[model samples]
Target: MNSTAKNCAALAKRLTDSGLRPTPQREVVFKVILEKRDHPTADEIFARVKSQMPTISLATVYNCLETLVQCGLVRQVNLERAPTRYCPNLHEHAHFHDDATGQVHDINLPADTLKQLRSLLPPGFDASTVELAFRGSKGSARAKLAEGRAAARSGAN
Candidate 1:
């Protein structure tokens, strides 16, 4: 189907799967996350969502984010002394943070490398999830943003 139809179906499934009530605020918040995919902090999300949903409060955004996280529809990414960023990727991967721009990028880990890393653990050491974050320069971060913007523009046309 069309992109809009696909997005609506996906959003509906997400709300139902997460046991969320699918309120308008939550729907807007989730749409912002899906549209941006830039790992936005709660403040940033609130700002973007405000233009579309003028009546939404920052507190409501935070509550929606918390509910999404608790329901397993999103993951929280934390860096040293940095505000928590929300990520919707539930796959086994890592995050690369650009110190200069405060940008977060998803780095997909090799399956074999992940397996080897898991093998290094001692006996009876159980880990539910593995997340790695690296801090570095603006390498490739700018390119990714440009690509996202280009795609968005094309989709809008």
Candidate 2:
């Protein structure tokens, strides 16, 4: 079978395992999220789904997203005062919000780093999940130099 078919089958299996029936809307939304690893907001997802399934309503997209998140198939990344975004990556990682570009990048968290974070909790309080987000711009010298070179190259061409 083709990749799309395989993906649909996998989605069905996951949803069924989560005790939710997989519908076409849920499948499409999940596919869109999987297609683009970028953490996208509900509106962004609605727009993308609308293109393929013109009859899909924003409400339906929202419902599908809620189902996906509830079923543990997707994660909702909440940034302060910004729209909530969805992430398909199930691994343990943190998100870096770039203030300049308004983009979210996934930062891998090492096992020891996670252990250290969990260690900070009180003896009686156990943490199920730890979410760490850093808000800043990529203003490092290396990043600046790379941007300058790209601009110069583009201008030359």
Candidate 3:
């Protein structure tokens, strides 16, 4: 099977395994989450899904999100004082939030770094999960262009 088909099958299996029925709404919601790895809020997801499935209701979307998160098919990224975002990345990683654009970027940590982080825990303290987040300004397209121009001028010196 192709990657898309494989992904769909995996999601369906997850729902089935989690004791949840993989309804059409749930499938579409899962697809939206996977298609846009931008970690969108529930409202953003509802808008996208509405385009595809105009009959879908916001309440239904919210319910679908809850079911997906409960099934481990999606992760809810809760930022302090911000709306929750849904993520489908099931790997161990950190998130960098661009305060300027309100975007979240996933950062894959090196195994060594993960090991060091775990080593910081006190003895006999078993930690199964870790959530690391960072906030900073992600340079804009205009800023990047200006930086490139500066580099070109400096190189010509």
Candidate 4:
């Protein structure tokens, strides 16, 4: 079978195993995540899915997303108090969050660094989960704005 078919089958199996009722709406959500690489937020996802599944409700999208997250098929990220974002990438990687544009990108860290960090932790502190996010504004616009703010603060001081 082709990659898309394989992904769909895998998602269906996962949902079934997780005791989630496999509905058409949920399947479409999974397909969107598998096809789109943007790592969309809930709103973004709802908009895209609605174009195809016109009858699908926003609440249904949210519920499907929550169910997918619970089934360990999707990762929900809340970067710096912004709206939560959903990612289909299951591997371990850091994230770069652009505060101005609200975009998130994945950054892979070295395995050795992860192991070393886990080793230095205190006893009884198991490092099963690792999430790192760098938040900043991208491009010259944000840079100029930040510089202006800094200048104003220094002048005030």
Candidate 5:
């Protein structure tokens, strides 16, 4: 099966395992996040779902999203301006938050990078998860910062 189908199946299995009743509203909310590439907030999701499920209340969507989050089927992209964004990509990765357009993009970091980073940690420290955010106006802030810092050091030398 394709990744999308697998994701949908996985989500269904999760809901079944979590003992959360699979109501129509819950299914719609799950599908909206699972299908969309753009990470949407709960309000955005409610607006989209309200078209087909006009009777479905906003509170229902909020509760369903929360339930999905708790079940680990959806990851919450918490930001200051937005209520909370949801992502179907559950793999280990970082996120980039655009300050100008307020977009959130997934960033995949190399495993060696994470390993090398952990090597520099103080003794007796154990790392579980690594989360890094590249925040900027429009461009890649992380790359820019690294390049700028490298240039500054070279110029000083």
Candidate 6:
């Protein structure tokens, strides 16, 4: 089978394993998420899927997203006071929310670091998942240059 067919089959198998039936809408939504690992909101996903499947409704996209999340096929990322976004990465990682660009990047954590974090919990407490997010501006080139110049002037004083 071709790559596209293989992907579809894999998606179907995953859905079935999760006791959910796979539909075209779900497949399309999954494809969009996998195509662009941009951590997009449901509306953004709707916009992208609509280009290919113009008949797709935003509600349908939302439903598909929920199903995918329920089935552990996608991760729901909630940034403070922002629309919920979806991520396809299944591995354990944190999120870096770029304040300036409004882009979300995955920050991979070392196994030891994760273990250290989990160890912080109390004896009777257990964490099923750990979510760590950092919000900051990924400085622009001009901003960095300005900072360098300002630092030089302050040092000369």
- Model 6: residues with Cα > 4 Å off, grouped in runs: 79-157
**How well does each candidate superpose onto the true structure, as a TM-score?**
0.46, 0.50, 0.50, 0.50, 0.47, 0.50
Reference-based TM-score, model 2:
0.50
The TM-score that candidate 5 achieves is: 0.47
Per-residue lDDT tens digits of candidate 1, residues 127-146? 77766778887637688899
**What digit string (tens of lDDT, one per residue) describes model 6 on residues 28-61?**
9999998889999999999999999999999999
lDDT of 2 at 84: 87
lDDT of 3: 0.88
Q: Which ten residues in a row have the lowest lDDT in candidate 6?
A: 72-81
lDDT of 2 at 27: 94
Question: 117 in model 5: Cα distance from truth in Å?
Answer: 10
The per-model lDDT (C-alpha) reads 0.83, 0.90, 0.88, 0.83, 0.82, 0.90
Cα lDDT, model 2, residue 36 = 93
Error of 3 at 7 (Å): 1.6
Model 5 lDDT per residue over 1-157, tens place: 9875676677778888988676777778888887775999889999989987899888898899889889987888873555777899877778888888988898897788878888888999998876678887664678789888998989965
Q: Residue by residue across 78-155, what tens digits does model 4's lDDT show?
A: 625556789998877789887778788888888887788788889999877977788786666777889889989899
Question: What digit string (tens of lDDT, one per residue) describes model 2 on residues 58-97?
Answer: 9999899989888777988873768889999999999999
Off by over 4 Å in 3: 79-157
